[model samples]
Target: MNRDKVTEDRKKLGDFGEEMAKKYLINKGYTICHEKFRCPRGEIDLIAKNQDDLVFIEVKTRRSLRFGEPFESVDIRKQKKMIKLAQYYMNYYKISQVNVRFDVVSVLLDESWDVKEIKLIENAFY
Candidate 1:
């Protein structure tokens, strides 16, 4: 396939994963505060509130484990970026004096684009 097509497909997969992640969080009693929150620096897939703590989430999706599990992609560099975005979001919204946590939701999809599994890792990083 062409580069453009590949990029588009990846984006579609990401969107689907994010939707799945959102639903999963909701089912777990998390109140979703935002989706696709973006700043000049970067974007976060989802933000939620779990009781008194505010949660910043990253959703990683994969069709196969050819590379690794989806959460494996959240390396140090990605974690740093997520921290920056979370800070930006809190500051932008004047949110303070609340506990904040980072979470990773990994989605695995089958060949037919059906969800195979969803894993949630809370407090994934500082």
Candidate 2:
């Protein structure tokens, strides 16, 4: 495939993973607050509320793990970016007086585009 096609396919895969992640969260009792929330700082894949706590979710999806684990891509720099995004999101919405946690959803897809593995890591970061 060409470079543009490759990039487009990656974006489509990400969207698919995010959709699956949202459903997974809803299945686990979380109310989806936002999807692909973005600002000058960065983009947050999903923002959700569960009980009294606000959850910031970062989704990493992979068709295969030839490079590394799906979640392994959230390096220190990426973590910092997500923190900024979460903070911005909370401040923008004036969300306070509640606990906040960072969660990660790693999704792996099989050859047929079916979900292979979905791992939810609560409090993956601060």
Candidate 3:
């Protein structure tokens, strides 16, 4: 495929993965606070709350694990950026008393955009 097509495909896959992650979280009794939360630093794919805990979720979607596991794509720099964004979000919302956690949701999408695997990692980072 051409570059544009590849980019489009990736974006579609990512969207599908995010939708699956949202559903999964909801089923696990999480309240969806936001989707695609963004700031000058970066974006957090999903923000949710379970009771008093605020969750910052990073969704990584992959067609295949030929390169590596989907969560492996989140590098240290990316983690730092996500943390900063989470802090900004918390402060902006004036959520002072809630516990905070970073999570990783890895979705493997099939050609038809069906989720083949969904892995949820909680407390993934400090």
Return the lDDT, model 1, position 100. Answer: 98
Q: In model 1, what are the clashing residue pairs, if there are any?
A: none
Name the best candidate (by lDDT).
Answer: 1
Q: Write the per-residue lDDT of candidate 1 for residues 6-59, one digit (tens) a residue.
A: 999999999999999999999999999999998899999999999989999999
Kindly report which residue pairs in candidate 2 clash with one another.
none
42 in model 1: Cα distance from truth in Å?
A: 0.7
Local distance difference test, each candidate? 0.97, 0.93, 0.89
TM-score of each: 0.99, 0.96, 0.92
Which candidate, 1 or 3, has the higher TM-score? 1
Q: What's the lDDT for residue 28 in model 3?
A: 93
Which digits, one per residue and each the tens of the lDDT, describe model 3 over residues 1-126? 899999998887888889999999999999998999888877899999987798999999988879888999988988999989988998888878779999999998776677789999998888
lDDT of 2 at 97: 86
The residue ranges of model 2 lying beyond 4 angstroms of the native Cα positions read none
Say which prediction, candidate 1 or candidate 2, comes out ahead on TM-score. Answer: 1
Q: Any idea how many clashes model 1 has?
A: 0
How displaced is residue 60 in candidate 2, in Å? 0.6
Look at candidate 1 and tell me the lDDT of residue 63.
98
